[model samples]
Target: MKLQEKKELLKKTVYEMFPDAETELYHNNEFQLLIAILMSAQATDKQVNIINRNFFEFLKTPEDGLNLGVEEITEFISSVSFFNNKAKNIFKTCEILVAKHNSLPPKTIDELTELAGVGIKTAKVFLSVTEGAPYLWVDTHVHRVLNRIWIVKAKTPLGTDKIASKIFNAQDLAKLHDTLVLFGRYHCIARKPKCKTCPMLPWCSYKEKNLD
Candidate 1:
């Protein structure tokens, strides 16, 4: 199938399979979501959730986070991967938020990325989820699944984002990201994907090439 046809098919199939797809990261508001996504880097949603359950109560907003010392935050999230670095970044980010944005999370990508530990991907997550910004937020799951499905052949997440943005319009980006992440996590897996039962198997280049 051609790229356009494949993209349409992938989008339709995913919408059918998971019509109400949303982020798995637990957060009641934008601030918590941003923090959760930051902590989720190099860690799983389950792991982040496990730690956040206890940690979030103490730090829901930038002001709240500012009150929690970096050492205390580190102690709270020590069980998670890279707790030391994440804690420090979180503290610095809170300081930035409190000082610059008056304890409110910035809505734009530029302002969001300006915070400590916030990268393009993290900013994209906040933008897409919070402000309803249209963007293809590429994570490991997005990069892997886009390549596997032949929507993008990039070797890196940044490359995948660029390629996907070219093929898919801004309006479709948030849905596409959610769909691909769900597919990568559940169906189009890293090893031994459920190709036989996968809806995208017919259009998947990885499955055709015997990569899955």
Candidate 2:
């Protein structure tokens, strides 16, 4: 099948497989979501969820985060990877939000990235989930899945995001992102993918070329 044909088929199958794909991270609001996404960097959703269960109760706004101090934040999230840097970023980000954005999460990517620890991926996550903005947020799962499936030959997350944006429409961005993430996490895993059971096995170039 052609690339476009394969893409369409994969999209349909993914939707059928996971009709309600959502971010695994737990959050009560936009600020919480932003913080969760930030903490999720180089970390798993399970780990973030565990840490946030207690941390979030004390943090309701930017001011709350700022007041918590880096040391306390580090202690709470000490189980996660790069806890020190993440703690510093969270503290600094809250200060920036209070001083510049009036303690509100910025609406645009440029403004969002100005805050500490907020990069393209984090900004995209906030935009896509909270603002309902169209963005191809390429995380490790996305980068790995796209390359393995031959949707893109890119070796970097930025490169994968660029390629995905070219093929996916603005209207399809949210659904496509969720679908791909779920697929990568469950079936098209990074280590040993379930090629024998994956629905995309027929169209996946990596499976056909490498696994077969």
Candidate 3:
């Protein structure tokens, strides 16, 4: 099949499998969403949600985060990876949001990335989930799936991001991002992919596909 044809088939299958694909990190609002995404760096959604369950209650607005201060913030998210730095960045991010952005997460990538912990991936995921922006947010999951499906051939997620953006239609980028992440996380997993029953087995090119 043609490349675009394969992409369409892959997209349709993934969408059918996970029609409600979205960020697993729990957040009540965009402010919390941004903070959650920041904390999700180097941490799993399960881990982040564990902390956010009670942590988000103490933070409603940027002021709430500032009120807690870095020390307390660190304490709250101590279970997550790089808690000290994440807490410090969250504190600074809140300050910027309150003093500059009027307590709203910036919608544009450039402005969003200006915040303390909001990198390209974080900014894109925030916009894609919260605002439905047509951005190709490439994480390890996305990077793996795209390469396995022959959508892109690159050594790094950043390279995959650039190529996938050029290949996939802008209209499909947001859903594709969510779909591929979920697909990679659950079905097309890194270690032992569910390949025997996978719908994409026909199109998948991963050498280590678990056919057993």
Candidate 4:
């Protein structure tokens, strides 16, 4: 089958499996969402949500985060990995948001990345979720899934992001941003993917199919 044909089939199968897939991180607003994503670095959604369950209640706005300061923020998110740095970045980002953006998260990638902890991937995720922007952020799961499915041949997530951008159009990116992440996270897992039950098993290029 052609590359486009494979891509379409993959998309159809993933969408059917997870039609309601979205960011599992709990947040009430854009500020909380950005903070949650920042803290989610090297952490799972369940981990972040566990901390944010109480942290977010005390932190609703930029001013709230700014007021919490680094020490208090660190205290709240101490359970997460690299809590100290994340706390500092969250404080600095809140400061910038309050001082420049009128306590609102920036709308553009350039502006968003200018914040303390927001990188290209983080910015893409934020925009894709908040504004319905057509940006796909390739994390480890996405990179693995794409390579296994023969959709992209790259060693790193960054490389996969670049190649997938060239292959998939804007609409596909929007639809895929969340679905692909969910598909890779839950279905095409890293250690032992559900290959036997996977709809794409026929076309999958992954050599070590756990069919047994």
Q: Which ten residues in a row have the lowest lDDT in candidate 3?
A: 199-208
Arrange candidates, best TM-score first: 4, 3, 1, 2
- Candidate 2: TM-score? 0.91
Candidate 2: C-alpha lDDT: 0.86
- Cα lDDT, model 1, residue 76: 92
TM-scores of the candidates in the order shown: 0.93, 0.91, 0.97, 0.97
lDDT of 4 by residue, 1-212 (tens): 78999999998998899898788889999899999999999999999999999999999998998788899999999999999999999999999999999999999999999999899878989999998898888999899999999999999999999999889988778779799999989989999999999989999999998986
Q: Please, what are the lDDT tens digits per residue for candidate 1 over residues 52-103?
A: 8888889989888778889899999998899999999999999999899978
Predictions: Cα RMSD each: 2.0, 2.1, 1.0, 0.9
Q: In order, how many clashes per candidate?
A: 0, 0, 0, 0
**Number of the top-ranking candidate, with TM-score as the measure:** 4
Clashing pairs in 2: none
Q: Write the per-residue lDDT of candidate 2 for residues 1-212, one digit (tens) a residue.
A: 78888778878877998898888888998889999999998889999999999999988899998788999989988999999999999999999999999899989989999999999889988888876678768888888888877878898988998988898778888777877888889877777777877777777778443353
lDDT over C-alpha atoms for residue 91 of model 4: 95
- The digit string of per-residue lDDT tens for model 3 on 1-212 reads 78988888898889999999888889999999999999999889999999999999998889999899999999999999999999999999999999999988988999999999889889989999987899988999999999997879999999999999999999999999998999999998999989998888888888888988
How much is 6 displaced in model 1, in angstroms?
A: 0.6
